[model samples]
Target chain A: MKREDLQLLQKREWCKGCGICVAFCPTKVLIIDTDDKVTIANEDACIKCRQCEQRCPDYAIFLEEASDV
Target chain B: MRSSQLVEKYFRTKNLPHIWCPGCSLGIATRSLVVAIDELGLDKNKTVIVSGIGCSSRAVGYLDFNTIHTTHGRALAFATGVKLANPELHVIVISGDGDASAIGGNHLIHAARRNIDLTLLIFNNNIYGMTGGQFSPTTPHAALGTTAPFGVVEQPFDLVKLAEGAGATYVARGTAFHVNPLVKYYKNAIEHKGFSMVETICICPTYYGRQNKSGTAVQMMHWLKDSFVLNTAYDKMPEEKRQGKHVYGEFVKKDLPEYVEEYVGIIERLKGEEDA
Candidate 1:
């Protein structure tokens, strides 16, 4: 499946703004905004590597319920 | 499966987001653990999680399992009793560096010597995080801590070697940066019978980082990536090139008589004698 096909979700309140996800994102798809929360800066560029999801220390960013496809 | 699904299934949702600092690697290590449990398809109802006092020990409070938040450095003692009472249940102990080595040091060695059927995961962040970043037994030599302002002069304990010397049936080390291998090690450690220990190297960016000028949280993560090498590669690297590099991998795996089974066997034998 394409990277953009996966629904990405982020819990802003849970984010502590560590930027681990932002730093580990291979495609530069995330950024810590002014509020110090992770936000999708370039969703279309995402490669679906899931590094951001895996590396996120706070569980702030993740893909929607993965299907068995 | 997706992380959200794992969280929904394995975690106490209301207790999150955890209180760990923004750059702390405890969450990552914790996630890998849940993933291992999920992949193994272990029965949540039949599993028990135990922990002692420390930053890493707080993990028990978040996990959705039969859990015990025990006294500092005594998690192994409580877990031993729990396992002996019900050997059918899977017992996993989570401990911090100071909790496992300094205060609970004797318990750790004795537990390993007994070869009890329990899994111990030590979150070795090299500092006493909960107590404000004091130097821990596993803290690297010459590293600075609140307790070691001028850097530590004493040699740090090599946890893998310690466990091996104590007679652990299964021993391995993994770091927060290498999630996949860590998950694999956790899986193996949990599945192995007799005393099993996994020393998970993690980053305590808030305390360990700030005190040592280790740069930002992101930079610390990179340092973990660059400095740590798998045991296999570490062996082949030149001695000079290996300086300052950390090694992690399965150090040992061997089966021995598990304590509970032996104790039970003795009981059964005595009962047979009485009947005769």
Candidate 2:
């Protein structure tokens, strides 16, 4: 059975690479790539609280819920 | 912390021990607002406190009045709607600098221009405290933030001036250190007939103060007490003496047709036509 929480990923092109989401996430689920685009490196640890989604300056990342998986 | 006090009565027992760090001025500002509300003897049932997302936005959660903690930077817009729907309701918007003047700047100006009957308590701690110490519109030039480690190149918005220019009927400024004056100004704003604003300068010791080497909360409070000159007293001081200091006091106050009242008039006129 898939875990109830889903791993989230980002669309690199959409990310201006602002690190606001990275700073805001209490769970530390997001990381900035070398190109300044944010990447969801650890999806399993994500609480899916949408802090990144709400704070992302570029709207680059989208959370895929566990139910979708 | 009198139980009979309006501010004390609305204290959230469940959220006891607030998350704000030591020396944060938001708690002081919140208490001043509540005290002002209580002193005015405003009907609790007709009071609505609205807020946008930020560390200070947590004020809505703690207040016992009708509260709506809306999306980031949208508290003014939401407060405008609440006041319009029920003209008798006393609506107040409480938010941080970023929430009020950065992303939510348009709403702030428009609300003032419309002369909406609402009180806006802008907690200007300079940096964006909630999402880390990021530079906000109110961040002083050369101040360090997570985004501007090298130093901020941009000039900060003077919110009281902006509100006064936008046509707010009553405009004033106060700091966390001056609690009694702050509360008194807040009460005046609440009683004012049109859009009234009180820009409360708060300390963010965890972020802005620490990064800027401004010392602890007490030190910041001392700085605020030292920095401001009351307008009533300032007018009597020499112009050269006032150059580097910020003057705080009521800046502008004049009655104008409120947005909701005009809107109601339009609705009534339209309804009359329909009946005719």
In order of the candidates, what TM-score does chain B achieve?
Answer: 0.97, 0.94
Candidate 1 error regions (>4 Å): A1-5, A66-69, B1-3
Model 1 TM-score, all chains together = 0.95
Show the lowest summed lDDT stretch of 10 residues, model 2 chain B: B1-10
* Residue B170 of model 2, lDDT score: 95
Best by lDDT: 1
What digit string (tens of lDDT, one per residue) describes model 2 on residues B179-260?
Answer: 6788889999999988999999888888999899998665776688788889899899998888868778888889899888
On residues A1-69, what C-alpha lDDT tens digit does candidate 1 reach at each position? 565567767777889999988998888999999999999999878777778877888888887634631
Q: Which runs of model 2 end up more than 4 angstroms from their true locations?
A: A1-69, B1-7, B271-276
In candidate 1, how many Å is residue B161 off? 0.6
Residue A15 in model 2: lDDT = 52
Winning model by TM-score: 1
Candidate 1 lDDT score relative to the true structure: 0.91
